[model samples]
Target: MSGLAAGWASGAQGRTARSPGIAVTIDDFDLTDTPLMSGEERDAAIRAALARHRVKAAGFVAGKYVGDSLDPAVLARWSDGGHILGNHSFSHRYFGGEDPAGFMADVLKCEPLLSGYAGFRRLFRFPYLAEGKIAAGRDTMRALLKRHGYRNAPVTIDTSDWYVDNRLKARLLADPRQSMEPYRRFYLGHVWERATFYDGLAQSLFGHSIDHTILLHHRLTTGLFLDDMLAMFEERGWRLVDADKALASPLLAREPEGLPAGQSLVWALAKADGRYEGRLRYPGEDGAYEAPRMDALGL
Candidate 1:
């Protein structure tokens, strides 16, 4: 009857014409420089890509990364462009490593810095996506979030852009003149594989497509490759939507039943269902698929 419903039916019927929607949310707004460029330069490149694509992202800022120097200006560039800013913790400490109270304090400490931005929203993505070690710890943090009126940001398409950036940074530092073709190919293929898997999982679990929230980072690799990444998504038929729209998916409201609960919401939900546990990958965020290739390339 409705266009969306009709599209869902077509997808349900195994039509290849339907494509999923997704939004980009970048984490750890650390402006530290990489071997190829200064922090400002990297930020400029990322901004340029966002501008060219006319895309706005939700940038979660770690207060520890912001200071009196050039960091505020970098944040301004994002907020000034109508991008949303969210809390990413003060010290980027893992909740599992620290007590629940300590972790909440770390989250609260970052609020002022996030509130300083005009686009600040009461959305919080965990450091390392580490919510807690057990049920009690997870519940503790959830209660704290409710009291503070913060929405927990859930990533649907999780990626390891940070690890790739680390390896790329190391290689660039070793030899700036080395060709980047191998790195680019590996990055694109790896991301594409993950995206396909997650999108398929969403369809299988929900009987239709849900807006996917992708987890990326503020790093040299993304700054260098995001434009191409977005292009690849476009070519694959994905329609990029705003972060808020993606996060508003009703599917995100369901809390999974177990502990060690820091993962993409999709993965957590699948685990809760227990029907597709075998499909779920452990330590969902890593560069294992690309590690050997990177090693062989001498990166």
Candidate 2:
């Protein structure tokens, strides 16, 4: 077995005794694309939230969105304030079904844009968590990333913030006066639910909580509610830590055997384990847990 696999095997014998902490990573900086909040407004809100929480996060940029809808100044704001920046692919294309060569090229396309940012880290998070449909595509990308000095920014806590944003946006558009209380409750509940679920998975796999890298987006929901989200996490006993430190968890190094290997690395590793078969959730992105609750709340 590879060293990483061997380490994982050894670690699996018992969980490490450590406190829970999380680093937030935001992807696809399309802040200007939203009509709900002006670019400046979104920037101010995000800045305020980070300051209020006294935390820093890593933002991944989609190169194509740079001049189209994403403002370069916005990225500067985050990096300047001690947050990190990384590539989110050039065009947010799914690696699955994509030509590995072209995908590598796309990733390279974003390096120029991100390389100058403060705290710019050599990290890359797969768009849509779709690594590849098969081993060749997945393996080729891994090799390319290694050759290019990039590390996979694997997520541990993956929630459906984007879907909730969509539902919230539709509601806002239909009635400007509609109460957001239900949306807020549903959003917080959904995130807490995912956190609990993934924490359980980590405990089962490693015998203790592993530092988590949370996958959230640069969207309206986050810009408006991130402070509350951070507060909720703290209330739940999860400390907010630096993105670089969180990604350093030994759990992130293990590339378990799996096809289209791009979900939370934790989920992928769990799925790759034969013992976890029939016990894990497939396509871990659905809103089935929150949909019914939101619908019942008349949201």
Candidate 3:
């Protein structure tokens, strides 16, 4: 969880591209056995939603989670349907509980599964967001990506649903006052806040149009609330592309011949400017806009 404060650093040279269309991506697709339903069952629900809303979503799945082994058939459904598979690691450890090398190994171990997905690969999303867990951990991970011929996936907006209790329908079920309960914080709210945060962030960052990789969990609660979530997408008129498209990171301009992915990374944490002006990834946040303390990033 400390990764929340410390993300890996990367130095991609690609100019930032923002579009009015939204790119929706969901994580932990193979993650089941909880308040949410099974991955297969969830897929059905998701398909129904896609057809209902005419929007497509990217499913970031664990290669090993499908039948506890690399099941190509299961993975194919997603790719065949035009949904992409994202890497989430072989084992879903709540806490990575190791150093950069250990963390990299944990993620790399799942490469077989990731690469096995329809033979079209090149994207990775940290389980629970590596950026937040280890400061500049994104650097270590990015190095891995470069070596493996993959790219870093950055999430512009995130939903806190997975971390909290299973209140999948809380916002929908909430009364006016209950809805306001989650909004005690100035910028964050309970029910409408998740959607509101992305919607507003989208408006502010790209002004109602931009390619965004949003982090959402594939869980029973989210599955239950799928209808409500899709409604917002329609209201916003965003085109749902495979979430993998969002992993566009800055690359080295020189394009060195044989650099390891770890060697290619910059290793810094990204900080959001409070004024909505711009966001910068730094080693640390200092005095509101400077680099933050690495110690705070769990680096």
> Deviation in angstroms for 255 in model 1?
1.6
What TM-scores do the predictions have? 0.91, 0.90, 0.61
* Candidate no. 3 TM-score: 0.61
Error of 1 at 239 (Å): 0.4
RMSD of 3: 10.4
lDDT of 1 by residue, 1-299 (tens): 22222333322244345468878899987787777778899889887877877778888888888895346888888889988899999988778834788888888999998787788999989988887878888988888888899889888888887878888888888888977777888787667666667776777788766778899898888888988988877765678787877777777666776668878888787777788776777877787866877798676
The worst-scoring run of ten residues by lDDT in candidate 1 lies at 1-10
Error of 2 at 17 (Å): 5.8
Candidate 2 per-residue lDDT over residues 72-132, each given as its tens digit:
7887888889988988999898778458889989999989988888678888989998888
Task: Report lDDT per candidate.
Answer: 0.79, 0.79, 0.48
Q: After superposition, how far is residue 274 of candidate 2 from its true place, in Å?
A: 2.0
- Candidate 2, superposed: residue stretches over 4 Å from native: 1-17, 33-36
